[model samples]
Structure formats: structure tokens, C-alpha cells
Target: MTTFGAILKAHHIDYKLTNRSSLDEWFYSILDIPIDELSIFDISRSIRQDVFLEYVLPRAEVFLYEDPLAGDYDGQLLYDISMLTEAQPPSIMAILKRISAYLSQLDKHNLDSQSIKSIEKISALVRN
Candidate 1:
């Protein structure tokens, strides 16, 4: 998991970021401070745009819901980020573009109801 993902997990937001890289330990070390005291500024300073795009964005699920194809349901990564975008480190347009590209390439028929709802939520983000 990427450090950013770990941060969300620490906050009780369960989004799985599947990038295992050399910098993982270095990033993890930054969290030695109490999780409750960690601020958005601290997170922004610790992570970069490249890391957010490459390691975090791709696997960020839109919604977490109980469905056979949906895996475990706990939280929505994109939704969580969207809710906190005012304090988010990465550019909103960058996030929107990446999500657009992902949706464009996806097979709509393969999506479950929760996934569709997830898509809807993200689409709402675009409108906003």
C-alpha cells in the first residue's frame, strides 16, 4: 500500500493502494507522529503529484458496497478524496481527467450496481 493509502486507512478510510515501491518505508516513517495530529498540509508535503497519480489513483475505487464483484465494502476512495478536495494536494482536473480516461476504457456491462453508483458519484464530482 502507498503511504497516502495508509494515511486514509489510519483515518479509518479503507482504500487499497497497491503500489509497493522502495520509498514505502521512507513514507511510512513519516507517520511516526500521532495519526490524530496529522494534518492535510503534512500529507501534501509528504506526497507529490507523481506519486498520487502513479501509485494511488489507478486502484482507487469509487464506492465500497456489498456485492460479489465489488470485493469488500468499507469506504470509497474517490468519494473520500472528493469530499476533502479543498485540502487535497493533487490538482482536481488531474484527478478528473484520470477518472475520465479510466471510465472510458472500462466495460460498462461488467460493472456491478455498486460500481455504477460509484460511477455516478464521480460523475457528480465532475459536475460540481
Candidate 2:
């Protein structure tokens, strides 16, 4: 009876607090991903591997690449995704692309701030 909630916990990703009956339903609705070809598992992994690769860039790939829910997941991840797949098959590549877009934007923001800080430090040294 492995559940998606258990899987998310193993990954240190907590489900957001919601007033809805089912947190999974709430999360999926908020995400509003238009799945058409790929599955949720595929999307999650791609988000970990190719998409958010650098977002989680510092972590070991084992926790992501092989199986994010492999360790302690009950079977909920599969069940939830199965229910979702009933609606529409998602495009695996498209999901990866979408995740990549968000990750790249985040990386740019982080890098820009870091760069500015580094530059400020260097300028202060020159002044001294």
C-alpha cells in the first residue's frame, strides 16, 4: 500500500497544506499539467534528471535517476498516476521541456544574485 504521500516524504518534498479532501487531487489541480503522452512517474523523473537537473544539481543522481520512490514508497505513486493516466497520455519530452524552462529561469535568477554579490565583494577589496 505504498502511497504518493509516502513517496513525497522520502524525497523531502512535503505536500502543501490544503483544505481539499484529497491532497493529491489538490496538488494535481494546482499543477494543471496537460498530460497527453507521458506518465506522471516519467515526468517526475525527467523533472529530476534532464529538467531540474541543476535545480537539484548538487544532489546524488541515485535518489532521482533510478527511482525517486524506490526506497519506501508504498504503491500510491503508481496508483495516483494510474488514475491520472486515465484522463490523458502526456508527452514525456514536453513535460521535460516545461520543467527545464522553469529550472533555467530559477538558475538564472540565482546566478545573477550570486554574481552581483561576488562583484560587490571584489570591488570592495579594490577600494581597500
For every model shown, what is its TM-score relative to the native structure? 0.37, 0.20
Local distance difference test, each candidate: 0.45, 0.35
Writing each residue's lDDT as its tens digit, candidate 1 over 1-128 gives 24555656667976433456645654555534543343443333332333443333433423222221332232234334334332334554456556655554566687666656655665666655
Model 2 C-alpha lDDT per residue in residues 1-128, reported as the tens digit of each score: 23334445568986675665663454444342422233445443433324332222222223323432322243222222222211222343333333233333333343444333433332332323
Clashes of each: 0, 11
Question: Pairs clashing in candidate 1?
Answer: none
* Candidate 2 runs further than 4 Å off: 1-64, 68-72, 89-128
Candidate 1, residue 127: lDDT? 53
- Global CA lDDT computed for model 2: 0.35
What's model 1's lDDT at 79? 31
Kindly provide the TM-score of model 2 when superposed on the true structure, using C-alpha atoms.
0.20
All-Cα superposition RMSD per candidate: 12.3, 17.7
**Strongest candidate by TM-score:** 1
